[model samples]
Structures are given as structure tokens and as C-alpha cells.
Target: MTPRPYLDITPTQLATLAPGTRLIDVREPDEFTGPLGHLPGAELVPLGTLEATLGGWARQAPLLLICRSGGRSEQAARMLARSGFRHLYNLAGGMLAVRATPVAQPQG
Candidate 1:
């Protein structure tokens, strides 16, 4: 009905992840590999190219968007929501908070 809504959650709260959750880092390549190392299994997909990258993903696919701060990731999550992804997650505070407080690995 309202399309897949964007869900904002802190990195720590996301520890208990479900299987098939896709981690997408929307920061620039340099930033992703520069200082704040990305999430454990995040794929580097710059924000500029996000739309094209989603071409092959299923509408129901789960996506977790990340960036330097919460801004870009939230934008990405909204973008995914527009694209019809049923499950969307935006990393609140992004890598900044992740660096301050380590994010737990996804539970099995």
C-alpha cells in the first residue's frame, strides 16, 4: 500500500540480524576504505550509483544502508523504499556511531 517503509535503527540495535539482510555502504569508495572501516559484510555501493545497483535485486530483498553520518544512509533507505524494497534499514548515526561503539555481528 504505502510501499515499503523505511526503518531507522541504531547500529547496536541491529545486532540481531535476520539472514539475507544486505548491507550497503553508500559512502564514497575512499571513505568506505579510508578510516571508518565499513560494517562486517557491507558492500561498497556509492550513493550516486545506488539506483543502478538495485536493478537486479528482488522487491522484497532486505537492505541496510550506511554512510559517514546518518544523512546519506537515510536518503538511500528512502530511495530503496521508493524502489519497492519491502524491508529497508537505515543506520542511525552511521559509521560515526559504529566506530564509537562496535556493532555486534549478526546472530545466527
Candidate 2:
């Protein structure tokens, strides 16, 4: 089977994602919830273990990967693409940009 390609998403664009979207933060645990904080529902799936955990992840849902400054997440996205993950996205500029963007609050 051919591998799928991943996309690059800016923080502003990330804010547009639907609530509850599966955001995979590929940073170390502390970094995920540390000084940078993290996306509201983003799960901590560090790059090192990402490949092993992919088997159990649902393929249909879009996966958004993030890290300190996008490098790690970019690698993670490529890894997922190689594994045939059809819908993958890397958070461009990572949390730094995410921190600068105004978060889109869920509409009531």
C-alpha cells in the first residue's frame, strides 16, 4: 500500500479545527504540559513512542502532531505518513505560534 502524505498547519489554522479533534502532542511529558502548556484536549504521544502506539489509533480521524518548535512533530508526521496514516498534520511553528494565536473558544 502507498503511504499517505501529511499536511502542515499553522497555529492560526489549528485554532480552526473542530473541538475534540485528536491532537497528538509529540513532546516530552513536561514540555507538553509545562511552560508552553498544551492544546485543550491534545494527547501526549512523544515522538519516541509514536510508532509503536500507532497500531491502536483510529485511522479515519485526522491526527495533528505538535512539539516545542515543529521539528519533532514534522518528523512524527513523516513517520505516520510512512505507516500509511492518511490524515496527518504537523503544527507549524509549534506551541510558540500556538501561544501567539488567539484560541478559538467553543461556541455554546
Candidate 3:
């Protein structure tokens, strides 16, 4: 079998995600609610239970994986790819990077 394919999305790029994009955070629920506040529509799936939640996510929309640091999310992406999911994206540096990123503001 061939290696599964996936994509990466940087923190800066994440700030610009289109409306309704599904951001699945594979981190623990506590981490998700703590500092590094999540994006508007991000959902907490947690790495341990991601497999069970995959089916419910909207496959047609862009699926972005996230975690505390990125390792778990990477694993999630691999699993999702093997399950025939397309448009899979792993947050490049996870919440650390996301927190470091500066959200752009609209200019009047």
C-alpha cells in the first residue's frame, strides 16, 4: 500500500480559514478550553477518541486537525487519510503556533 497523503496549514493561514471550515482539535478537552483559546468553530475530538468521531464530520468541507503541539494531530491526519477522507489538513504547529500567530484585523 502507498503512504497516505495529507496537507499542512500554518497558524497564520488558519486565521484566514473560510467560514464554516471544520477545525477538529484532537487535544484533550481541558487543553482545548484552557489558554491558547480555540478558533471560532473548532471542535474538541481528542486524539484518543478521534477515530469514533471521524464519520460525523463534514467530509465535503475542509477538515483541519489540531492538538497541543501537533504530534497527535499528525497521527489523526494519517488515520483519517487511510479511512478515505480527502481535504485533510494538520495544523502546522498546533496551539503553540496558533497562539503565536497574530490574527489579522480588517481595515476600515
Candidate 4:
């Protein structure tokens, strides 16, 4: 087994995600669109079903995982890293931090 790589990123750092960056929210559906709105272009892939749903995703694509708190997303990042997916990052402080800062808008 290889070492797990963990990368922590912030909202300000993500102000300009490079093209093809997959910003994913590992929170539940309700939480995604609830009081704490999700990132501009974050895809809803709740952690519970993430493994099963990731079967066809591009393993090499840049992925930014997020959750209500940083814990769950960190878990997801580790999982992907173990599965041979690199370019993984967890949103530092998660949505709670996002709520405190203006987030990046989706790029065209």
C-alpha cells in the first residue's frame, strides 16, 4: 500500500479552480441546498454513496472534497487516495468556512 496524501485547501485558494477541477460536496442532499448552500459548481455526491458512485469517474482529474465539517470530506479524500486517485484535496474547514467567506464563482 502507498502512503495516503492529504491536501488541504481554502475558499480563497479555490477562487479560481483550474478547468476540470471537480468540486464535490460529500454532504447529504438536503444539506447541499439547505441553509448552508454548496459551492458554486460543486457536484452533490454524498459521502454515503461516494464509493459506489465513483466507479466511472476519472481518477486523474483534480477533485476537491467537502462536507458539513472537514471530517467526512477528509475521509473521502483518503478513500480516493487509497483507490489510486491522486490530485485529491479537502476543503479546509468545509462549508462552515465557506459560510464565512464569499466563494469562487463557477468558471465558464
Candidate 5:
């Protein structure tokens, strides 16, 4: 099967995620804690559990996959893409990079 294209973005770009963006944290639950807090509104689906957890993903919306680093999330994104998920994005550098950027507080 042909590989699906991934929309790779820097941590700064994560600030752009709005209500419509489907943010997915592909890191393990333990890894999700500590210094780097998760992106607000992100759905947690550990990479190991992705296959069973994917049934609930919104097929229509663009999926932004994230992890401690870019590696695991990219793998997860590719798998989802192969499974017919259309819009897939890999957050380049993942949470580490995201944490480095100055976060814009969500407007109330």
C-alpha cells in the first residue's frame, strides 16, 4: 500500500490547534506526565494501544499525532494512515519541542 503523506509541524505550530483540530498523544501514560504537560484538548492513545483505540478517532478531521519525541507518533500516524485515516499530521520534535515554545494561553 502507498504511504500516506504526513503534515509535519514544529512546536510553535501546535499553538495553532483550535477546536476543530484533532490532537492525539501517542505517548505512554507514564511518559505523558512530568515536566511536559500534554497539549490542551489532546486525546491520549498510547502507541501500544492504538490499534484497539483507533475505532473512536474522528475519521473526517485532521489527526495531529504527538509523543515525547517525533518518532513514535510518526509511526502511529503512518499506521493510522494505512488504515484509511485521511488527514494525518506528525508534530515534529513532539512534546519536547512543544514545551520549548512559548505557549499561547487559550482565549476564554
Candidate 6:
């Protein structure tokens, strides 16, 4: 299978996602909600649950994978790519990096 393109983006790039793009948070629910709220519109699909969730995802649009740092998301991105997700993106430094950027705060 052809490898999908993984776009590495910063928090600023969130605004650039087109309407159909999928934002997936690979962190556990606790981690997502603990101290750092999730990105608005991001679907909470932890890494362990990605495969099951993939059945319902849109293969056409890019899947933006995010985690605490970038590791888990990158793994998730690769897993999805192997499952034939044509477009994938890894948040360069995850949510922490995104939060550090000067962007509009996301409402929980």
C-alpha cells in the first residue's frame, strides 16, 4: 500500500483544516481532560482504540493525530496509514506545543 502523507503542523495550522478534515486526539480521556483541555472539534480516539474507530472515519480527508507530546500521535498516524487512510497529519509537538502558541483559546 502507498504510504499516506503525514502533514506536520503547529497549533496555528488548526485554523487551516478544511471542513472535512478529521482531528483525532490519541491521548487517553483523562490525559485529554486532566489539566489540558482538548482541541475543539477533536475526536477522542485513544491509541488503543484507533483501529476500531477507523471503520467510521473518512479516508479521503486528512486525519490529524495529536497526543501529549508527538510520539503517540505519530504511532497512531502510522497505524492509520497502514489501514489505508490516505491523508494523515502529526501535530509536530502535540497539544502542549499547540497550547504554547499564541492562538485563540479553545472552549471546552
- Give the best candidate by lDDT: 4
Q: Which candidate would rank higher by lDDT, 2 or 3?
A: 2
Q: What RMSD does model 2 have?
A: 4.0
Could you give candidate 5's per-residue lDDT for residues 5-104 as a string of tens digits?
6788898776675558788898887777757879888888899999998886777678899999899999998898878888888999999888777766
Ranking the candidates on lDDT from highest down gives: 4, 1, 2, 6, 5, 3
The regions of model 2 sitting more than 4 angstroms off are 1-4, 18-20, 102-108
Residue pairs of candidate 2 with colliding backbone atoms: none
Can you write out model 1's per-residue Cα lDDT over 1-108, one digit (the tens) per residue?
Answer: 674378888867777667889999999999999988898889999999999898998888788899998899988888888788878888889999888885458999
Give candidate 5 misplaced runs (Cα > 4 Å).
Answer: 1-4, 103-108
| C-alpha-based local distance difference test score of model 6 | 0.84
Q: Residues 2-108, candidate 3, lDDT per residue (tens digit)?
A: 75466888987765766667888888888889987787788888888888877766666678899878889899999887777778888988899878877779999
Determine which window of 10 residues in candidate 1 has minimal summed lDDT: 1-10
TM per candidate = 0.87, 0.83, 0.82, 0.87, 0.83, 0.85
Which scores greater on lDDT, model 2 or model 4? Answer: 4
Error of 6 at 63 (Å): 1.3
Whole-model lDDT, model 3: 0.81
Clashing pairs in 1: none
User: Local distance difference test, per candidate?
Assistant: 0.87, 0.85, 0.81, 0.89, 0.84, 0.84
lDDT, candidate 6, at 15: 79
For residues 40-64, write the lDDT of model 6, one tens digit per residue: 8888999998898789777777888
* Model 6: pairs clashing at backbone N, Cα or C within 3 Å: none
**How many steric clashes between backbone atoms does each model show?**
0, 0, 0, 0, 0, 0
